[model samples]
Target: MNIVVVSDHAGFTLKEDIKTFLESENHNVIDCGTYSKESCDYPDYANAAALAILDGKAERGIFICGTGIGISIAANRHKGIRAALCSDIYSVRLSRQHNNANVLAMGANIVAIPLAKEMIKEWLKEEFEGGRHERRICKLDID
Candidate 1:
């Protein structure tokens, strides 16, 4: 999978760790950065990652922030971007299976690296049900 990942200063370390882990799992990752732990805005990175998905540069995205809330909100502003903020395996699976989410957002402060890895694994494994769920996801594009 070709995945784009972005993070602010607060999530730099976690983002780097996740990037390495994803790479090891054979995912081609585009690292959209804050670069180091210097203070920086989350929206900039969030928008860049979201644009990668919108522009077809990446198949999926993983965005990180202190709480993941702000970044997810920003990504969701793009039409067709279903950015789901998930901290658990069940939510991660449902996000893909039901929402057909193209993006996953996680809080560096809220989830540990191991748990986040498991959540990502589960998310990648689940396929969208696309029956009644497809009807609901279609509603998300309404103006």
Candidate 2:
């Protein structure tokens, strides 16, 4: 999968680690970054990654920040992006399965690297079960 990843200063280290892991797993990764630990706005990176996904340049996106909440909010401002803040494997899977989310958001401070990796793996493995859920997702797009 081609994935776009973006992070603020708070998530820089974790994002770098995830990017390496994603590449090792043979997924194409586009790192939109804060680059260094120097201060930067989370919304800037979030919007960029969201646009990449919305424009069909990426299959999905993973956004990271201190709490994940701010970046998720910013990414979701784009009409076509359903950015879900997931803290566990279940939420990650369900975000794709039920919400058909194209963007995943994680908090660098809330989860360890290994746990985040596991969550990402599960999320990537799950496909959206678009039977009954399709109607709801359609409503989401309209609203």
Candidate 3:
């Protein structure tokens, strides 16, 4: 899978770690960055990663911020980007299976690296159950 990841200063370390893990799992990862622990806007990175998905450069995205709230808000501003701020396995799986979420957002301060990886693995394994779910997802696409 081609995944685009982005983060602000607060989420830099977690983002880098996740990137390395993703690469090891044979995913083509794109790092849309703040580069270091330098202060930067989360919205900027969020928009860039969202565009990568819209442009077909990536299949999905994983965006991070201090609390995951701001970046998730910014990401969902894009018409087709279903960005889900998930911290648990069940919600993560449901986000993909029922909502067909294209982006997964996590808080750097809220979740640990190992657990986050586990969540990502589960998220990757789930497929969207498209029936009533597809209809609901379509309703969500309207501005």
Candidate 4:
């Protein structure tokens, strides 16, 4: 699975950690930066990740920010990008299973490295149950 990881200053460290974890799991990763902890724009990173997925350069995305709110909002603005800001295992699972979310958003302040890894593991392994959920998923794309 090819995944794109994106983050701003606040989420830079955790985004690197998550990238390492994803790579070690044998998945190809595309790092769309804020390479340092210096302040940067979250929407820029979010746009890069969403475009990567839309362009077929990546199949999924993992985005991080201070509160996960701004980044998720930016990603969700793009049509066909269902970015889910989740802090729990259940939310992570359901994001993929029910929402068919291709983008998983996490908060750097809300979730630690360990918890983020656990959530990502659950998210990556869960298959989307696309029956009734497929109808709802289709309605998400207004463009």
Q: After superposition, which runs of candidate 4 have C-alpha atoms over 4 Å from their true positions?
A: none
Candidate 1 lDDT trough over 10 residues, lowest sum:
119-128
lDDT by residue for model 1 (1-143), tens: 99999999988999999999999999999998979999998989999999999999999999999999989998999998999999999899999999999999999999999999999999888899999999999999878
Tens digits of per-residue lDDT for model 4, 33-63: 9799999999999999999999999999999
- Local accuracy of candidate 2 as per-residue lDDT tens digits, 75-102: 9888999999999988998999999999
Name the runs in model 3 displaced over 4 angstroms: none
Candidate 4: what lDDT? 0.96
Once fitted onto the true fold, the runs of candidate 1 whose alpha carbons sit more than 4 angstroms away are none
Question: Which residue pairs collide in model 2, if any?
Answer: none
For model 3, how does the per-residue alpha-carbon lDDT over 15-123 read when each residue is reduced to its tens digit?
A: 9999999999999999888799999989999999999999999999999999999999999999999999999999999999999999999999998999999999998
Winning candidate number (lDDT): 4
Worst 10-residue lDDT window for candidate 2 reads 134-143
lDDT of the candidates, in the order given: 0.93, 0.93, 0.95, 0.96
Cα lDDT, model 4, residue 100: 93
Winner on lDDT between 2 and 3 is 3
Each model's RMSD to truth, in Å?
0.7, 0.9, 0.6, 0.6
Candidates, ranked, lDDT:
4, 3, 1, 2
Q: If scored against the real structure, what TM-score would every candidate get?
A: 0.97, 0.97, 0.98, 0.98
